[model samples]
Structure formats: C-alpha cells, structure tokens
Target chain A: MTSTTLTPSFDEQYVATRKVATVGRVEISDVTKSYGANTVLRDVSLTIEPGQVVALIGPSGSGKSTLLRAINHLETVDRGSITVDGRYIGYERKGDTLHELREAEILRRRTQVGLVFQNFNLFPHLTAIENIIEAPVAHKRLTRDDARALAEGLLARVGLADKADHYPRQLSGGQQQRVAIARALALSPKVLLFDEPTSALDPELVGEVLDVIRGLARDGTTLVIVTHEIGFAREVADRIVFLDHGEIVEQGTPGQVLRNARHRRTRDFLAKVL
Target chain B: MSRIVAPRSETTAHAAGAATPATDADATTDDTTSASSATADAVAKSGPAGGRLDAGLRVVPVKHWGRWVLSAIVAFVILQFLWSLATNPQWQWDVFAEYFFAPSVINGLWLTLGLTVVAGVAGFVLGAVLAVFRLSKSPLLGAAAWWYIWFFRSVPLVVQILVWYNLGYLYPTLGLGTPFTTDFWIVEFPTTTLISAFAAAAIGLSLHQAAYSAEIIRAGILSVDQGQLEAAGALGLPRSIRFFRITLPQAARAIVPNAFNEIIGLVKGTSVVFIVALPELFYTVQVIYNRNQRVIPLLLVAVVWYALITTVLSIAQYYVERRYARGSVRELPPTPVQRARRWGAEQWNRLGDAHTAAAPPPPAQPEPVVTAAAAASDQYRTGGAA
Candidate 1:
C-alpha cells in the first residue's frame, strides 16, 4: 500500500523552491474558545516547527479536535491568536489592535492551511479526482489542466490511481479517507491538519489510512493530527501533546509523554488507553 | 394432473435466481418447461410417486379476494364512463378533433408554454436571489426578503394580475430618479404603455411563483448536509463556488422534484391569466366556445393539451431527477424504457425456449461475493435509501 512514487517529487518541491514551502511553522498562543458557558479550549498554547509532525492525543472532550480546527481558523477563538509562518489566518494586525480580516481575505489565507475531517467529508457530488481539483482550480492556484495533473499525482501518491472517477460513495472508508488526504494535498497547503482521520473508519481499514499519513510525514510536510492511534503517534510524530480537560497536560517526544509521563492525569489517561 | 405436476416441478426446480416464498408461485408458473432433466432429478430425489404425481408439491398462490373485487368495480366504472363518452353526442368528438390541432389553438398552446417558461425562469432566478438574501447574515436583507415573500404570497394571484394591469391608476409613469422626488427623472415610461396585458400577466405570475420558489430553494439549500458546507469552507473555496459547485448540486437532489411540482402547478396556474385577456390555451378555448356555442368539446381540447404538456414535463422531470441523482443513490433505478427492453428480452428468450421444447436450463448464476466494494455500496444504499 505504501508506494513512494510521488513522494520524491513532492519532497523536492517543498525542500527546493518556495521559501515557506517546507517551513510551515504554526503558532498558537493563549487560544481560548468557549460555547456559551462551556469552555472547550482553555488558553491552549503550542508551536509546531518546520517539517514537524505533531500528534494531539486525548479523551473525547479534551479539545484535541478543536485545537486542530482552530489552527485552520475553522473555529474562531475568543482569546489569543494563531498564525502560520508568522502571518495571521483570520486576522491582520493594524497598529495596536488585531482586526479580523474580511471573508474574502480569510478565504485567501485559508488556502494555506487544509483540514481533513473525521468523517472524510469528501464532496459527495464530485468524483474523487474532481474533489481533489475543485479547490485548487476554484481558488485559481492552478489551471484546470495543472490541477487535474496534480490531482492525479496526489491520487497516485495515496494509492488510488484507478479511483479517479469513482464517487465517494463508491469507495470504502479507507479509500475515501485516502482520497481526502489527496484532496488536501492538491491545494499544496503549507500546513495540513487531520481531525481524527481514522476515527470514522472500520478497524481493519485504519491501517491503510495511517500508512498514507506516514508517507506524508516523510515528505517534509508539516502535519498536525488529532488521533487516538497511540502506536501510530509514536511511530510518526516528532512531538506528542497530551491534553486533558481542555488543557495541555504534557508535551514532549512520544517516548517521554507515552513512556514516562510526568503528570498523574497523563499517567492515568495513558494507563486506560494503553 | 400428473402431466401438470411433472412440468411444474421441473420449471420450479430450474428457476434459477428467483426470489423464494410467496411470489415464487407466480414466477414459477411463468418459467418455461425446458428443464426436463432437472425434473428427472427432482423425481429421483422425491423417493417414490404417490398417485402418479411425484414431481413437486402444489403451490397455491396467496389470494386477495378484496383486490379482485375492488379491481372489478374500478374496471367496470372506467369502462362505463368511457362507454358514455363514446355513446353521448354532446362530447362532439368530431368538433373536438377539428380544433384540437387548429392553427389558432396551436398558437395559444405555444403561448401557454412560452408564458410558463418565461415566468418559471424569472421566478426561480428571483427566488434564488431572495433565498440567498434570507439566508444571509444581515438582518435587514433577511427581513426584506421575508417581507417580499410574505407580500407576494398573501395577495390572491388574480388580484395581483389585475393590480399589475391597472398599475397606471397608482403610478402614471415609472421613472428612475431620486427617492421621493420626481424633479430629475432619469428615464420614464407610461405605466400603461409598459405594462401590456401579456407583460402584466408575466409580471404577476412570476411574482406569485417567486414566493413559493424562494421557500423551495431555501429549503433545498437547508436540506444539504452541514458537513458539506464545512468541507467546502475548509477547502478555501469562494462563497460563489461553494454555492454553485458544492451546495447547489447536493441541494438540487432535494430541490428538483419539488421545483418541478411547482412548475407543473404553474403550467395549470397560467389558465387563470384569462382575466388579463392574454390569449393562452385556456383563454383561447373560452373564446372559441363562446362564439361557436360548442363548450364541452372546446374545453376537452384544452384539457387534452394541458394533459399533454404536463406529461412532457413529468417525463422531463424524471430524467432531470435521474441526472442529479449521481453519487447520491447507490444505483440509478432503471428507466421505464430500460425495464421494458429487459422484459422484451426475457420474453424473446422464453419464445426461443418454447420452440426447442427441450432447451437446456439456463446456467446457474454465481453467488454474489461480499467484497469491500459491496459493503461500501451497501453503506451508501442505506444512508441514502430515502
């Protein structure tokens, strides 16, 4: 399932040409989000460096998915700010105040950060390849022909070359998730986020999707994955952040947070999951 | 009885790929007696003949006496009504045929179709704009759209038509100028000259239809999965692209059937435009009948034309719905023509078998394998079975 045909080309493109191509540094500072009285993210702060893959692992209500979505500005934060490559996603700083950018401006910036949903959420009406090419073409980032080629390349990279014309419903959960990964890659986003990519998949199908993500990590693309796959996190992630009760409890290399967690809450959480 | 049992058992035994149980009785009866070897196999398996009938058990079809009685009554009523129509001279079948395709009547038919098309398109366009406005975040826009829908839907259509026709009474001239002032009229035209009977009818029908179309389009947009919008937004697609490419296509699956329903209603709704003196089909029929004193036949002509128009629309709706059904339904339901073609092929194959008298049984179809594709297809089937 892990064919490395297209990764070499992507690696060269990211590592060679563009200045911020390989370095999609994500900065999240004091980000707090709340829904009425229910606080979901409590001043959560984390930084992911160039080419780094960070896995956010926690319980259901631990705000892991919210943090990932907020990175892409999918969820608005009540306090603090998030930036990729030192540029705000949903806002622009003017003088002393942070002014929220207009919808068009925000959409322009959102192209740099792509989010994959837990449900795979591939557009049902479009075929897999069309779904991949739609955003890039619509945003004018690529010509239709170029977008199609990129889409085909991405599809091959994810091991679904023959499924270009197949609809989402025609694909297995694993195949659909793989196509979602290809779709996110088609935008050539500087930062790619996965909000529990494999959570909705069948147990046996999880491996195929994870294998594709592992290939992405090796291609020098910055990735932030919210996942329950602890073993997968250990194998691919450069940093693993353990969150509990809407706060980051422990942050370190997988060996530290997983093997010798300092906090008792982290230890208890690990004890249950392990 | 022995002969009948022997062939029946052979056919039932060799009826490959048929569903089991209740419906099997009818299906087995239709099966050709071309599998005599299979009959011998059944006899060999049945131990011994009891009373020169060792083929298979008798299968009595489950009977519905109520259905029989109801169908008989319905058929008798339909036949009697048709008999009366043929026997009665008041129908004026000759006069009906004469004007049914006459030049003047045909022109009226064209006018009806033209009005329906123009008003339908204009209504949907305005409705789509209003639906977007209603769904927008600005309260002012939403309230304005709401008010427009309310006003248009509240007034009776005929009254609206008359009001539009008599718009000159309210405003002698329509002009583009500063609000609340006629000092510097940029461009002006007399209301009567601009609002002809046909124009008034078009405006009235479109406005009346727009209110319903707005609700239909809005409900259609709302019917789309929230996740679809999120996915489009996450892709960084522009709002226009999001609406046209992502939301509208999915929403179309919900919108089309209801939209066509409204359009079909509008086709008949155009009949009421006779008040404005527009020469549409129903109005032309009224005019001809008033002059010739042949009311029933002329009315029948108009009825036949309306039925024809609606039939064409219904057929078009089916195809349009099938087109929009891509990726939503697991397999497109077979079209009627496709069903007929398949049935004809089966009948032709049965005829071929009838000639041979000892044709070999059709080869058994392989059991369908439950692969990942099948499981995924089943998932979509259940999810979208609605």
Candidate 2:
C-alpha cells in the first residue's frame, strides 16, 4: 500500500528521455453492449475532434454513461469498433480479423486518456499529491521528481495547492473531486472524461466542481461529460446530445438542443429538470 | 408504497390524539403482509391504555435484568474455575514451575514459533499466487489454481506428512529437469538423502495452510467495490498496473483480517507435527511427560504457551484490521493501548471515589423543559425516538 515503494525503475528513463504524448480524435462506431437480455447501449456512434467538448445528457439508465465508457474501451462493444488517434482501442485490426491488444500496449495508450468519476475514486490511502502521481509514475514511467512537479502544478491548477498532503477522507466532497481532476490531469491526457462529477456533491458544493470543469473547457481539453446538470451543460458545452432509451434523442448546439429541441422526449425531460 | 399507507395511519393516530409512536413505524412496514396483520392486531388494542403519556415529566426507567443475570453467571463460573485451579493438588504446581522454562521446553517453543512463521509466510505467498490464478481471466490458469486448492484442502495434514516422509520409497531419485531428455541440467539426487522428516513436515503444513489461504485471499479480492476496477479500467491502465496499483491496495482492506485469522490458526496447527516426530511444543511436552510422568503439569506447559501466543496474535489482528479500515468506515476505532489506558483511569477514579464522597455534587443546572404537546409532536413525527 506504500505507493512510493512501488515506483518502477523505468519511470526515470521514460520521463527523462521522452517527449510529451498527444491525445488523438475519438471515433466510436456502431457500438452495442448488453448484460443478459437487457441492452444497455444499441448501435451507438459518435465522433469527437481532438479538442472539442461534447456534453452527453440523459435520464437515468439512458446509456449515456455506457457510451462514454465504450469510447475509452472500458466496456468492449459487441459489434463495430472505436478508434482514438487512428488506432483501434482495446483491439488491433489486421485484415478482416481483430486481435485484442497486449497489456503493455493498452497501458501505453492510457497515458493520453483519463477518466474522473462521480465518487472521486481517488486512492483513499494515498495523499492528494500521491494519488495524482500514481498512474504517471507507476504506469506512464514519469520519474519521481518530474511526477511530483507535475502533480504540484496540477494541484495549483485545481486550487488545491495547500491540500497536497491531505488524504481523500480529510477533504470535502468538492475538494476531493477537484483532487480527482488534478490526478486525471497529471499525465496531460488529451482527452478527459467526467461521469457525473458533481452528482455526489451537496448542492452548495456542486459549484466548485463545475468551476474546475469549466476551467478545463476554457483550456480546450477534449472532454466528454455525462451529466444530469442541464444548467452546467448549457453553460460549458459547445454541443449537447440528449439520449433516451439507449439511443440519441437529439444532438445540436446548446441553443438548439436546450431551448429549441424538436424531439418530444427531449422536451419532456428538459421540462422536468429545468 | 409506504407513502400511500403512512398518511392514513398518521391521521387515524392523530384522531385518537394519544397514539404511541410504535404504531407509526408499524404502518410504514405494512407492505409486508404478515407485518400488516400484526399491525392490525396491535391497532385493535389501541385503547386509552395504549395511549402515549407525556414526554417531559414522564420517566420510564426500565431495568435490563437479562444483562445483569447473564454477567453474574459468567463471572461466577470463571471464579469457580480459578478457585479450583488454585486449590487442586493434582495440578502439581511445583513441577509445572520447574519444567516451564526448561532448556528442552524453551527450544521446543522456539521451534514451534519458527515453524509457524516460516510455514505461514511461505503458504501465504504461494496462496496469493494461486488466488490471482483463480481470479485470472484465462480459463487454464483458473483451472490450475482450482485443482490445487481442491486437492490440498481435501487431504488430511497427517496423511500428507506421512506420504511425503515415505516418498523416497516410491521414487529412488528426484530431479528438476525436462523429463525423458538427455540434457539433465538439474542434477538428480537420491530422494532419501535429500528429504528429511522436518522438511517433509514443513511442506505438509505449508501446503495445507495454502489451500485455506487461497480461498481467504479470493474472498478478500471479491469484497472490493467493482466500481473501483471499472474506474481504473476507464483510466486506460494496463492489466498489471490496474491490479498492483488499484486492486491490491483496496483488496488489502478485505484480505488482512482473514489472512491474520489463518496465521493464528497456523500457530496452533503446528502442534499436529507430532505425527511426524518433529519436536514442536506439544510434542516436546509429551516427551517430557512420558519421562517424568508429571502428566497434568506437562500438558499445562503446552496450554500456557499456546494461550500466550494466541493472545499476542489476537492483539496484532485487531491493530492490522484497524489499519486497513481507513476511508471504508467513518472513523477508525481506538487502539488497544488507548482502551487500556482509559480503563486504568476509570478504575483509579473508582478506587478513590470514597475519599471524594464528602464533596458537594455540582450545582444542579437549570433543566430545559419542553411543553408536553410539543414533545409528543416531536416523538410522533420521528415514529419512535431513540
């Protein structure tokens, strides 16, 4: 459980000799997922450019989270494929057959993509700075010193500079969520995904988390946010996609989707929440 | 469902204007058919006698007779056992004192401790690998772990030890190399010359311990929240990284408690090595008793040593469990040292209480009283006040 002891030897070499990696555009095509007879997602397809921000909004169980998960290869598709930066995710396409990627390849690819979750999912045992540097130093092979500096910069970015030594349990919900953001940003991933980042926070604590995501959006980080906050989405997202019954109900600019949605389901859902 | 039924009962209770809070809770759980029937029976008896009295001035000082009776019985039994042990002549207290720290007995105790630690560590390491194999994605790996656990756990340790001791008879020579190949890189040795009785016993003990440890570790791994694995996956960490970094640390919270349980079991389990003629504590005590015929005292030596070891291990288990319980629970419970300190202070205060009896009690503070109607309303809203 002592993370400092588990830092791999390659960390120094990878950080000292390598250049920063870039994240690529994401492509998810005709992806479908199911558990037993219950279909979670059905033939979903979407494309996000390198620096574009897209917000996915939906009612509970509408498959928005599943679609976001499929993009990062967390949940594999039963049919069709997804690619990031022109390379197939989780699998390699050779001729007509597809072969799953090896563990090393998958890890190397993960450095450019990061995920932040509703519960923060920060390693409760580690301090804030340690949590931020864990993946970078352990998997990405960033040297200990370099990872520390990067983590410190990220803590400052998230307005948690004084909380580097605090454990997740010691931090408030908003602070923990901000620390999670810092951890995700540690690797300078090109794409960042948030799944209901503020849903676990109290009403008053929700604004701080939204502000951090707003900061990321202003910096042009390619983000796919699955959220229930209609107001936050309209303010931060360039495009909003409404999902219902495992399908996209409507997708357009904030003005078009939020104010002038043509779909009946979208309007009904908007009416209830708004 | 509760929302629909709760209001009807609440209104009826209000109409009676003196209903106890018990019926309010009963109405919420009325969805259970059996419970509703019980509620109906209780409702039928909601007469003036069943009405709730005022809260502020009313004092219901119920005594817990069951707790006191059980505590007294337990205390009497323990005291009687201690009294018997002190007065009994058959115990041979002098002989026990003489043999307790004998060089032979001390060596045997040391051997028992050593064997427990060495075998316990080796077994746990082996079991951890098997556990990971059982949990591995590959079917072949899972099958290998499953079969090993099954075989080891099924066989008796005594039988295993005896079989290993006699293995040399079945196989004259044992070697590590590719079978049927001319290149014998791993040198062959006569099995009788290489395998000793002590080594055989250790192997049997470790293998037996491993089967149990593997299951315990697997249960620990299974206890971790699945969302943790999902989030780590979404972060694009490699399989190994995901496991060592995220999975193992979180799983440690679950693994440490049962793992220590196995270690404590292994400590006493070392006594079974007497079948192999190994000089562990119990075996040494048996050897002494056979020579001197101080039967009860010699057996007491083994019992005392075991009790001491188990007590130490129990304390260790408590602290280890507390260490891993961080973040999972609201707060970690106090350590044994802190609890002992507090107990000592309380006992000291009790002993000195008579000297301070002449001191006047602290001036009575003004009692804040609520209107009976207000208190009744508060209790009514909560269903039942704690």
The best candidate by DockQ is 1
Off by over 4 Å in 1: A1-21, B1-61, B343-386
Expressed as tens digits, the lDDT of each residue in B1-386 for candidate 1 is: 45555665655454322444324434444444445444534443442332124344544466999999999999999999999999999899999999999998999999899889989999999999999999999999999999999999899999999999999999898979899887537899999998999999999999999999999999999999998888888988999999999999999999999999999999889988899888899999899999999999999999999999889999999999988889986577899999999999999999988976685534575335635666888999988654
After best superposition, candidate 2 residue A249: deviation in angstroms? 3.6
lDDT of 2 by residue, A1-274 (tens): 1212222244233224333324558887787888889888888788887767789998999998888777777777788788888887677889988898896777677667778888988877678898888877777468989999999888887788898988888889999999999888887787898999999999988877877787676566788999989888887777899988888889998899999999999999999999
lDDT of 1 by residue, A1-274 (tens): 5544424354334335323335699999999999899899998999999788899999899999889988888899999889999999998988888988999889889988988899989898889999999998998888999999999988888999999999999999999999999898887888899999999999999988887887777777899999999988987788999998899999999989999999999998889988
Question: What local distance difference test score does each model get?
Answer: 0.86, 0.79
Alpha-carbon error at B380 in model 2, in Å?
42
Model 2, span B201-245: residue lDDT tens: 888988888889888888888877787777666555667777787
Q: What share of the true interface contacts does candidate 2 keep?
A: 0.47
DockQ of structure 1: 0.66
Residue range with the least summed lDDT across 10 consecutive positions in model 1 chain B? B43-52
